[model samples]
Target: MDDTCAGEKSHLFCGFFLNFSLFGTGVVYTLTSATSMRAIQRANCYHRDGHDAPCSVGGDAYYMFLFGLAQAVLLQIPGFHEMAGLSVFAAVMSFFYSFVGVGLGVAKVIANGVIMGSIGGIPMVSTTQKVWRVSQAVGDILFAYPFSLVLLEIELINTHEMRFDQMKDTLKSTPPENKTMKTATRASLVITAFFYLCCGCLGYAAFGDGTPGNLLTGFGFYEPYWLIDLANLCIVLHLLGGYQVYTQPVFGFADRHFAGDAASVEVPVPMLGKRRVSVFRLCFRTAYVAATTALAVWFPYFNQVIGLLGAFTFWPLAIYFPVEMYLTRNKVMPWSKQWVAIHGFSLVCLLISAFASIGSAVGVFGSETS
Candidate 1:
């Protein structure tokens, strides 16, 4: 907003919400994804005959820890910018994993009588630890869609130093850019929801009740070891892409705040003149990645971390930011019908998040039977 709205209460409040939620979200994002990488890698070990590695708080996590550290170092290469072009490979791998998971899942259902917990693939709440597990489950499921799409919207595709720049120097496009962005965002959201629902349905059906955090671990067919190994390899590739997608933004943000223009970091490459890696580049991003990897190894609870993270940020980031930013940017009166409706929706999101937060706390402190 170029400090135009700095003195205004609404604008300041929006900035606070955005920054606070984004910081929390970044940590959770890194840890959760790194944990996923660890889980899949460990699951791959299960493909070995009589050699099953446990998935949580184990040695494989250290391997992912090294992977994250290596990513930070390799990201310094100028070619790292071309990583976005590798999305085709990521997409292919994602589709391959999805098809494999679903195909095997269907065969499993046919053999196992479509064994599911309850509610169309949603699990039933058991009596033991019902309060804690059910509440945590509710929070996790609620965090799955709608507003969560805002994370992709707000952060993806070179967000111009993580702020909207009015299609000026940063975006540098005609008015149609706005329309294109909106259309793309909506389409992406719909596609994502559909795919997520399908994956959940298939995964839940494959293993029935009490599925593990990583679905690949639950498979019994170790005879096709190569296929299992390939599937887990795809998971690694997919997570590596995601690591770039998320960590680069963090690097860009910190680099800009510290060094004005991050691209100006001089690299010792003849093909690129006046580009050299600054000391800040050497130290900051490396430290950030190392810290997150360490935390991922420390608290390997994938779903719990995500649930608690969602509980804390979902209200302010997703619901509050969009509504508040809309009113502030578009100059909608706060008391108008649209404003009231938006705030009311935000209120509902806040209530849901509050319950989720409580549930996550209960899960952490109480004895979880399920």
Candidate 2:
């Protein structure tokens, strides 16, 4: 890779997609938090009233605003590195929720005494509808690549270089940075894939053709009302940290670009260990949260939005860029076996991304029109 050329291109694509991914994630999280909160309320209502009673809950706008308020407050954390504890806490919450979901699925399956779904999946759908559903499912699964999203953040500009350096500084010198990163990526991917499979398969087995987009909030298991409530609460808490994890890089980028002639101003907050924070960070992040909140309220189709964002960004950021970088870095000769193989892989991924994007676009606009 020509250092200058690669650097410039990296800056362009990374900046745009990183911002897009983070903004979309903020919107998704906002909607998800609202859904989870609503689920909690509905769970309580169902438990109180009979299961057959009319326990309908209304708009999610209220919960969205509440989530936005929470984010505005939590957005005060100085930078990405400051969110270590928050990330850990969020991970714990996620594990708890995942476990709860899986457990509920198992219990439901046992209660039913048979796996609910068929090998064919949703038997009555038309061919076109099935194709669209399959494509959206692909996109939804691709949306699970938050691991790549985080790596993209660490691959951006000077701020990311600083982040990279921080990681190096923390790691022991024996295994080397490349090896360590690859290992960690593999491990994270494996663990994430396992959890996804467990939850998805079990949920399908339990609910079959009637499965909802989300296992926890879809009201699949109502008898364990308290457990469902706790699971949704964990989702809310997890998303609270998740929003920061995805957006802090954007915050860092803005702080760098928008640092005009004005001298940096730091205000001391006695509550937060007397840590001084930038006033610009406060204003900018608050506005960012508000914008995302507004978008979430405007277009709140969670699954479609996730599909669009994932399919739209997947190939370029996750596949093509990385492959090109690798080929360039290793000086792979054009049309050589390695080059052809790598490009072939990228081409296949590009096609998949394209298909997914079309499906997701249809879903998004279709929902809007209807």
| Predicted structure with the largest lDDT when compared to the true one | 2
Where does candidate 2 stray beyond 4 Å?
Answer: 1-7, 152-175, 261-279
TM-scores of the candidates in the order shown: 0.74, 0.89
Highest TM-score scorer: 2
Give the clashing residue pairs of candidate 1, or none.
Answer: 266-275, 266-276, 266-277, 267-275, 267-276
Q: Encode model 1's per-residue lDDT on 11-77: one tens digit a residue.
A: 6665555444444444455554554455455545665434555534465465656667656755675
Residue 117, model 1: lDDT of 63
Which ranges in model 1 have alpha carbons more than 4 Å from their true place? Answer: 1-58, 78-83, 120-128, 146-175, 220-223, 260-275, 329-338, 364-370
What number of backbone clashes does candidate 2 have, counting pairs of residues 3 or more apart or in separate chains? 0
